[model samples]
Target chain A: MTHQRWFTPWLLVAPAAVWLAVFSLWPSLNTVVLAFTNAKPLGGGRFTGVENFARITDDAQLGDALLNSVIYMVVCVPLLTLLPLLLAVLVQRKLPGISFFRTAFYTPVIASAVVVALIWGWVLEERGLVNGLAQQLGVLSGPLPFLTDRWLLLLSAISLTVWKGLGYYMIIYLSALGNVSRELHEAAFVDGAGPVRRFFNVTVPGVRNTMALVSVLISVSALRVFSELYVLSDGTGGPGGQDMSVVMLIQMYSRGFTGHLGYASALSLLLFAVTIGPMLLLLRLNRKAA
Target chain B: MRKGWLIPVAAAAAVLLLSGCGLGGDGGAGEDVDASGEVKGKVTFQTWALQPKFTDYVQGVIDAFEAAYPGTEVEWLDQPGDGYSDKVLSQAAGGSLPDVVNLPPDFVLPLVQQGMLLDIEGADDKLNADYVTGGIDAYRYTGHNGVYAYPWYLNTDVNYWNTELLAKYGLDPAKLPTTVDELIAQARTMKKESGGEVYLMSRKPELGDLANAGVPIMAEDGKSFVFNTPEAAAVLDKYRAAFAEGLMPRDVLTDKYAGNAELFNSGTVAWTTGGGNYITSLATDNPTLAPKVIPSPAMGTPPLYAQGLSVASGSKNLPTAMALARWVTNAENQAAFAHLVNIFPSTKASANDPFFAQSDGTPSGDAKVIAFTSLAQARMLQPVEVTGAMSDIVKQQISLAISGDASSQEALDAAVEQCDKLIGQ
Candidate 1:
């Protein structure tokens, strides 16, 4: 057996360990401490002891934000999970110009969210392409308030999130599909299973673990949605701030004279608590599978 | 002995964690300085996003200041426009604020409250007489006892109308609205004539509009808001009624509402309020639309906007910092700056400058002439205490009222209550 100095392991991990301590552990601990205070962004703070968390109960804006999160998650998880898997299956085959199609679908995933949101903002404006085309088709008498109405704005952000996320999840599904048993697929085909039957019985069960992981990722991302909603609404949080996400509330209180860093920290803790539910659920499901 | 390294690692971790929390430090406090000493030290001067465009002008001013002071040096730092408030706040908290800093009226309020800025009036008694009353009064907060900054530059809003759009919609471009009631009547006429294809108004009523209509936005002491009066509600009611009648675009209350300048550029709106340099800037964006633009005085008490240079209270070189601030804001330097841009000079003596009084027969030149004259009657319409967050609450409440979700009075009351709560906090 080789003998090494006692500090060798420590020296190797010191860089990563220090980074984690400074950026992650320290900030998380400080956030916990700050959540009990009334800290302004300019740095004067005193312990108010649950006052911020107490305000969360009566905050009508928080209530609206929670509802928006639920709607976003409920819609995103299923669409993102199944649509990406189907897209992976379609593109997994060897075909002519397949790389081009794959790249075309994956382009939005690589595009900057701000640029994408700005383009969508122009596309959904009252005089934009969508409304103009619809009106020109004699399908409507007037333009629809796609970017103005609260529900429409929320739905628009959700659509953008899903559109942008599709290629990312598709690549994950493609990697998982490669690991599935090709023999099982061929055996099911020989047994006279149709494409739909084979996909459900063979392909799905094979990638069930990857699907759970994707669902968890989608759930956390939907709960933590910021840029899609922020850029879409130009950072106003939609009409009367009714379509705000919890993360948006945190960002709202993180700067400027009106910013309360302590309250933002409390909101951050609440977000961590909310997101942990999906993660715990995934862990439970994995344990059952084990 | 096997885990000897753990002790040092744990110690370092604890130190990092404790330092990150910033235990026992009151970041808001700063030591007051006496400015009665000789001015011969290096002073750091910071401006907001004025580089590359005004580089030569600012460098020239700095060079002149150095020449006048002989041994003094001015280190210039120009910050970008985005996230400037947050940047300044962080710098103040970290005790790294520049010696001489340029800040607007609203941005000065927080620093003054924290005692981070020097009292300019206390430092120099005769300095107040150099600047215009409106310019000096902007730096005087309601609760603050002394002025905190030397007023630098002044600008006010000018109404820009698209003559071609108005003429196309059968509204006379020569006869522009001079008051809110007249503006609303023209909006109605334009709405009917254009079949709602175009809009005269493209924005919701802000605090300035309510103040222009004679609503006191705050109480005398400035501790709380009192703009929920019937007069304010009446102004909102007019907007609500006009909105219901499709006189203004539906999206104007929402985030989808780009400002009036954008809507004007697109030819969807006939009016936008901008600074004296509006026509010059507009020509760069859309040259075709610039020639057809008409400049007129704002519909109400033209809202005054001022930028000023403040001295950091904790600055070691207080004398040089204060001297540099005063020298930069002097009438000669201000007039030189005004000559480069259409912005007005804050110094009272600059009012006599012929450059501001005469028009070069261009649209922008006419705008400068009108803005210069309007500055005489202009005041800071929106109080500095109304923060961005408070403005957002007002925006949301007013949006609720305009969309028929609540009455105008209820909206104003809610806005006042929320804004007052923020102030109390």
Candidate 2:
């Protein structure tokens, strides 16, 4: 009976355990192994012993990609972390049509990233809506190259990331806000604390942990961004291919005759390393806070 | 309790590690086949994005082939256009490629390097005489001697101009540009006359353009890129000067720029290059602008684009697969297929067919006649060895040159250096 009990539990877990081993754990290990080889997409390769990693140091494109990621993370972390919380607070109360507003705010989260990026591409084009309006109002003499200039293209992709991320992070904030003590809010109100003052002292402190979590999430996503930049730049990685992210580089090396699976795996490892920094920092900060 | 749980977990890990070995196995080179055997067996045929619209046409071909060759069966697989390259690579890696497959010339290069495609010429020498010389030459790689695929349908780029847009911008449609220099001059005139309200050129310089300007894109040995020559730089400089003068749109070099066809359909660009079927497709997409389109022969040696059927080297039914590949691309079948669409047939017998020779007096018919004539002179302007990665490098460098971020010579030099490194890899 005791032996059967152990075997039965194993049988129950076998499907999920096998799935995890095959999909997640195996691919991760294979990536580490492949990083040391020169595997092509069509399958023949040999171990080159850190040759791919060595190539990374001299890669100008990787330099541009890393810089783009830093800029993306820097701009995204603050905007995504704060704006969503404000949006959540605005729609948190059980007022008439609050559900409608909440749904409207969250609609972008449900939209496909490629579809969203393409829509944003048309909106930011030289003869697109924003430029036409800006010109009509006499705000500018010439159309701004929103999708052409390097800096403007990067800023446009960043804006898209923030816009698409707003509803998602807002929902996370909404759930965290519900856990804040209503009694503390009432007590603050009785003491004549204004909305802004109460928000700073009570609401801000209450959701500090959630904000930390959201910041880390935004930072990681910004570093891993591909579709927004890819679709916006029409997969050319913007002018001079300077707007590419690490993930986009990985994709570039994983397709067609240009594909180098080993190199792509190496890039994947680099991305994992880059993202782990913010994640580990978050974990340490959360531990200290606890 | 710990030991009992560990046993199952360790067993699972072992199984997974063994399975991983299978994933890393090489896509083995197929053994040579005695393709002279009787054509009898089941063969898998694959086409790219040809279903629904051409289902009846393809099915009729298959049925006719089957009836002609007794004891032969063909299973057809039509794949969607998206992610087709990835799908083919995966299939090749697994050694599960179809017996016969449709692929573009560039797409067949890596497979040929891997020995995944059968050398059709070596299999059947007589088949070579049936295809047009240019079509046959397309499947022959620079370093490889054998033709890897049966030449199927061929098309060449034809220049399309919007007469209405040209008239609106005070440019004469009757005096349309026929050379690159003339095109540039006309663009400058249109820009100055329209006050930059419309554009005549909306495309960046690609490898085909460089080749058209007499740049030796690749070395004679096909081992290195030599397009960094003075002539290439001179061509780029001309484009840079035009770009600086705003003859082309600023966004044309960026990803935000729509393709020439889309811009032409919108009446924003007065000139664009498209295939023989371009007007037909344009009429379907934009009916109002169809009548205003005028077709002209492409400037410089028009770029030839060919789609061919390649038999997998490892096919179980090698004889039948080879036979089916040949039968489908035969002059009769090719002419029949061409009749349904504006694409030119690749077979030599179909070259002088009256159907392609005569125009029904419409603009689309004119495009057909022009394209058919262009096919006679068209060559594969872009070398088959230029991979996607190399193209990306050229695009980025040329963009930087046109945008004045780098000099034309510097950009071409950088592009050559990077492309040589890629080929070396």
Candidate 3:
């Protein structure tokens, strides 16, 4: 009898449910469907199953993109996850004006990515401040080509990504750090454990769940690193296509020369598979860990 | 419990009712009840004019268009100084394209091939004959059924020199390089004479500034890449030598479009190939050390070139768009735009517009007359099918070659192979 009345609660939620179904869920499903076909934004294409996947496999540019994506994930994910934790712990200390330090670190998040890239581009230019400073300090006889050279290009882009993301993830860890029982650190010290060991055993495990959550978040972000590369290299990626990633390839596929909507859809589907499948697997692992 | 359920159920019903009412209200509000099938609508117009130097004139013209056409609104959209093309293409793919847009003249063929444009009324017909003969041709693509854009304006590349820099280097103030070889020699001379303080010449090695030159770097025949020829390599070799001689920075290969401009304005670069408006900008921004504009040194023969504008084919109101296009190219409007912009006008009649006559405070003299005659000879890049992919492939490979990562032969071979693949597709 009580269950009969609960039907009204379900009915009341129906409109929001319908809204999400139409806008979010349906579009995502359509993207997957279109990815399997040669359909364009204007529509009209026949289905082609694993052909897109096979084509992505054979494409040299796509291969390069996949490699770059993996590289970004491998380098950026752990650094992004760990650096923020370290930064949060350092800032959370009762050092004077810790609040001001937190605000200063978070400020980059408020600035737009394009602006950040532009500022960094200037700082990294051949005669830019970094090179000028290095030369003045007798560090090098010549300036380093930050945007042009492959090694430096990737280094500069990754550094910018880590810098921009630090404060945001710092705040996340900061919140988690707040809930850590202070008594645990005291007990560890009473047992005569050093500060470093106490931090590793007590502080780290105290926020293990938050660290896991942020790791997954950073992994997903690493999968979609486009704007920083695009901004640094003026849309073409770095010279010789050294820093080009999958998202840039997807963009080029969609609207570049031929605007092969079908090809782009195929690439999109492949990208979705690459990004989401692993993310879900990781989430499942996280659940198991929990 | 039953009463509580009623509250949620009533809320859901209210939401459904409110949405239905909203939809109905929207449909009623914008209904065109007038007998005339007039679409009083707005269309976005995107352009790359951003600097305080150029944006005002562009915005002024757009404003004039909207003012002239009472019902049709023209929204001006400006791209930022960097990553302008990337943003433009992204906006196009997202299908939030401005109804009207301007791409660099050389990019017209690629844009058409991508199906980003809509067919217009005046592409191939006798209507195109009314503008400069070759102007409409550049905006046409074979893959596109009809003309996709209308010819907007023409500008010619000229050599700009700081007479102060030239005089200080012990070079003649009035004389300029007359041939490719002569330009190289002068570049070397300027470098040595200036104690390596100034770059005698500054331009991107990819020859982007030269893409508009009247002669094709590679001919229309797809079989061979002409830019990889001995003559073009000779040009690149000169740049390589200049770079080696410390006339230009070794990292010149990495400099973006504005790097040379900055070098020129800052007085570190003595002479360079620059846009037509450089002299005007110099006079306006840096009056004391205003650079003198002169004809480009001959490369076999003096060739002329300029950027072109076109109307998009996918426009919803074709006639209105055509009207706007025609109006912009008309003698009166071209003259207005010319006065406002100080670039050469598309129309012959508008070339003599008082704007150019009074500009530089120079009277209708031989130099002005010669500049106009050169405009007549000015040619844009020919419209080629498969240009979009072909050019990108060329750019990619050439960038590699310029960076010393690949040989010229390897780059051209890769480009040709890529071009073949694209053409086959």
Candidate 4:
């Protein structure tokens, strides 16, 4: 009788399982398979196993993109992780208009990416507010080539991502901070520990689970930072086309040469490996913390 | 009278036969359909546009098509512009695409290379007999042999000027600028006349997407970007000169499309580029705003250029799609489309129409002269080559130069390096 009940339950879940297997698992499997084949979007072609990956590895543009991606992630994640924690701490003080500050930080995350990008484009354009103010303040005589120069373009894109991520991540940190035992902070204060020490030693340790989750989120976010780069650099990435992300590279391969679908699939697998391999390691560490 | 009746019957029979051949060619090599005889099924068009815009145009075309072929119903799966080509490719990969799709000209060749597009060369020939030569070529992406795309509508960029502003600045409405030098001189003259109360010309008018559009004024060869070339430098120098000389305000770069158009309507900007294929409607749409068209003066050596449109190869309904495309380019329909769109027709016949030649005599100026001059020496967007990095190079370099972040040379050099990388030069 129990076995019959278990069969019905399995049967009930079969449709959804099948749906995931077909839509998700199948496509992923296809991506991995096609990575080794010279199959195009429309017509089948010869197998070119490891050739696409070898080409990507050898390509100078991909190298630049990879370097840029690393630099972007390295620069952005720390700021994204720490800034929100600080903001959450500041806002958690129950000071005057703290709710307003919290709302302000959260507001940017709710705005559409396109709107955010457009507004940022204006603020960062050659003669935009930053330059104008800098000029007025005698900080610089001319505007920075924020989107034109490869280095500045990467920096600008990362900073914009940070700005957009800051508020949302801050809210998350705040919720986690709220869940921290009030007794811990009160005890830390009783021990004559300074605010900074308490934050680093006690507060951080308490929110370890949230930190692990948010770190993974930020890491993945860094890996897929497409919109900011696309919008800022007008989809060319940047000058010398050095800032094109792996995702952008995949898009170009898929689109520009529709006949090169196999190569694109290969690139897709490469991206998946680059993104998930590290992500899985982080997940393991996160599991260890539990 | 009997001879005329025979000609009519013959013409009708010919169209039917041609349409049939077109349908057969599109439905794989051996697949054939008797769409002429009581065809009843729903065919969907996959294209780039949101629901409202897509629905309106698709519905309009479908209604016309269904009225002509009663048993056919057309549905739409509107793809957003973002990741549009990718969406189409994914469909192609899965061997599933809508019956028709409006493909960007650049995507046609690659799709054709994938053997995705139906070879509608024969049907295209019929369309070419009626459509403008250049317009047809816009759809001919293969350079030779394969004709993958059909020219749906022809668009050409032109100069939209404030006639009232020109006259106010003691400039003759008939005498538009013919060269880069003349354009600069006109801006200077207009600024002095206006006493710096308004800009002589706006760099980028803050209009919707115009701010980020980054339309580059490049060289003729399309091999080299001129935005940083001496000629481009000269153009930029003239712009910077205009700003420095107080002929144009530094703030002009902040102007959007609406602001720029408004500037012209309010007699501020002396001249600017008109909305391609929709200049006339821009005027007609705003009856109170008096604006006129002028030919875009040669910034470089020879003829001026405009962007073009082409059908996508991924379309499943190539026969009906080609037929509908032909309908948009036919002399009568071209005239109607041009009249409705309020822009110059690509075809010489419609362009040379008495209606286009003789202006409606609106208070702004002679619309016909404006239309004709603008169409006389038009160029087209450069073909996708070197990984299709031309547009990117042009946009980046031009933005740098315009913003004065980099000298014309530095920007051009950087752009050249990028292009070289893409082309493997």
TM-score per candidate, chains pooled: 0.94, 0.93, 0.75, 0.68
Which of candidates 1 and 2 is the stronger one according to TM-score? 1
Per residue, candidate 4 scores C-alpha lDDT tens digits across B1-425 of: 42465688667645543332222122232122221223345666665663663355446655777788666666667777677777866776566766566675566655555455655554345655655566556556433354545444444445666666778777877877765457668777777777766555666211111111233433344443333346445555555555556565443432223235555655557676554433445556665554444544323322223222333344445555555544444566556655554455556567557776665555223543454555554444354443433444444454455556667567556655555433321
Q: Point out the worst 10-residue segment of candidate 2 chain B by lDDT.
A: B17-26
What's the CA error at residue B300 for candidate 1, in Å?
A: 2.4
- On residues A171-221, what C-alpha lDDT tens digit does candidate 4 reach at each position? 888889888999988899999999999998889998887877787888877
Question: CA shift at B389, candidate 1, in angstroms?
Answer: 2.3
Of the true contacts between chains A and B, what fraction does model 4 have? 0.12
Report how closely model 4 matches the true complex, as a DockQ value.
0.23
Every model: Cα RMSD to truth: 2.6, 2.8, 8.0, 12.0
lDDT of 3 by residue, B1-425 (tens): 54676688667655553332222221111111111234346666776664566666666666777777788877677777576666765665555666667666545554554555655432334445456655555555543445555566666555566667777887886677766556668777887887766777665455342343332454455433455554445445555555556666544544444457667777778766545556656666666656344434223322345444455545566445555555656666666665554456655566455545443543112234445555655554333443444555566666666666776556655665555543432
Off by over 4 Å in 1: A1-8, A283-290, B1-32, B255-257, B358-361
Q: Model 1: which docking level applies?
A: medium
Model 1 scores a TM of 0.94
Off by over 4 Å in 2: A1-12, A187-192, A285-290, B1-31
User: What is the per-residue lDDT of model 1 for residues A228-256, given as tens digits with 9 covering 90 to 100?
Assistant: 89988888887777778999888876668
Candidate 2 backbone overlaps, count: 0
Predicted structure with the largest TM-score when compared to the true one:
1
Candidate 3: how many backbone clashes? 7
